[model samples]
Target: MTNLLHAMLGKGLGGLEQVFLDYQPILEAWAAKRGGRCVGVVRNGGKVAAAQAGRTPPLIPMPAFTDWDPITLGAARAVVRANRPAIILSHGQRPARVFAKAAPAGVIQAVCVHKPSFDVTPGTHYLCVGQHLANLALERGAAADHVHVVQNAVRPPPVQAQPFAREDGPVKIVAAGRLHAKKGFDVLIRAVGKLRAWDVDVTCEIAGEGAERADLEALIKTLDLDPCVKLVGWTDDIAGFLATGDLFAFPSHQEGFPLTLLEAMAVGLPVVATEIDGPVEILDEGVTGRLVPDDDPDRLAEALGELISDRDTAQRLGAAARELVLTEYGPDELARRLEAALDGMLVNSKA
Candidate 1:
């Protein structure tokens, strides 16, 4: 039953880092109890230096991907040589490719498909974050029997009621994600602009940081929404931040499975997200959240406005959302599911 979960970091920043970082502590403690080990490989910054500084176990870090040298197969082979882990679980596309090559014959390899990427390798099993991603992986050549859907989970902060009174006032709308083009924040800004024509008193707060910050800010000003829109950068605490808003909006063009929607639901906020794959799978249109056409700010805005204008309905929906998350997305339950999946893979491989 000896095992190790190898989490590799590609870029020094972004949602992937945030996600893998959150799980490191949990996996480390859990592995120690089971007499196994889990290691994180951060490829940038003071990762290697920092790991050595503390009494914590060592993790591998390599040079950044370059034109001449892609992710080296040798490095992956060396890691497996050192750990001698019975199973390898690689997160993200590139890691999967490297692990597929590096893993010894008979070692189980589970690759996580976070988004659309050209990283699929032959004879590799997949752990998709959402149903859409599971389907995408199979369609893109991953064996159907080798793939499983395992949704991401977050430890919801203590339930906090909206700070501002829930009365009918300025409709505070929120869209959260890294300020990347894939997030479709510009589309959200445009939708907000269109909503203004209807004299809807709305203010949108885009919370996150990325390359698209300047562009989105400029769009807000150009659309005469400088007063109505604000781009708040990344925050350590999301539930508390979202508690100040009335509705949560996500217009991402693509996703593995966004924890943002679930976080919002846990905090009892009614959602108005794009009817994209991830959101559609989590939200039932008239139930936990409203699903609108992707990139269509018109529908997004209309849905946001509808939720804001009706307080009783909004409260009812919010209550339902919170209940749903508690019942279905608990962190402990999710961890158990992951452990079971890994155990199944281990047992089936031996058979």
Candidate 2:
């Protein structure tokens, strides 16, 4: 049975971390069914442990950023020796660098690229989270055959007896992610302001906390969107939150296959997202959801207005989005693809 180690530079509960938490158990179960094993390795004292909540194969916490430090490297190498993993799948750049040096000979090393900026080390296979990221990896000198595009997946939410959002009440719009500039929460807030000015009865709830919380709060106040826009901090119940919203607005300036967007789609929320790499790949312009230009509040406002004004269109798009995810990006399908990739890597290592 092949033992696999999934390693990551654990920091916060962002999309990357979420991907690790969501897929770790599924991958572990898949491995177990095949008479193999999957284990997780993350930086010591990071939030990843809390997110895992006692799930397994098991999680091994090690020092982060210890790229060639003899002592830490020795410790990591010892873990590798003890586990004897045939495949080491590193989540981000830092973890990739650390594992590349620590993994013993014969162990296949693969890096999962979850963002635009990544290190394309020679001889390491890359699992790009989106097609756009895969293209970027190829441009950065990664071997074309070594890079694989793996779309993020989510389980469809339990069917609700009744639709969550009220068609008669003020439309509830939800957007989630780290409160950072890259997320473009400011652009979303401005869009909400414009909608409010046009007398559209809509309330926007920005979930998840980060460094940009104060600035976002200040912008909300400046725009006189005190009651219309609320910055709700980090939420563990993302599915429940999305269930209550009429629409999902993702105005991110950058992304690498955002799990929340998939989650939103799974719950049948019509999405209005920025026309960036990840969103462009996910949303089919007006089919699954509406796409707006990145960082453009006016265009964002226009898109939001279109969905808010047309409930029928919103419901149709949301349903289409849900079907798209269920059919193409389900957890089981993604897990199978991952298993195939791991198998391919093992064979390549032998070659």
- TM-score against native, each model: 0.89, 0.94
Candidate 1: residue 143 Cα off by (Å): 3.2
Model 2 residue pairs with clashes: none
Q: Candidate 2's residue-wise lDDT over 162-234, tens digit each?
A: 2335548788889888888899999999988988888988899988988999999999999999988998888
Cα displacement (angstroms), candidate 1, residue 209, comes to 1.5
Error of 2 at 182 (Å): 0.3
User: What lDDT is reached at residue 322 by model 2?
Assistant: 90
lDDT of 1 by residue, 48-127 (tens): 33444454666567544532344566666677887777767777766666666677787778776677664556667777
Error of 2 at 22 (Å): 2.7
Candidate 2 stretches with Cα past 4 Å from truth are 33-35, 159-167
Worst 10 residues of 2 by lDDT: 158-167
Candidate 1 residue spans exceeding 4 A from truth? 29-34, 46-59, 64-74, 163-169
Scored against the true structure, residue 139 in model 1 reaches a CA lDDT of: 83
Scored by lDDT, model 1 comes in at 0.74
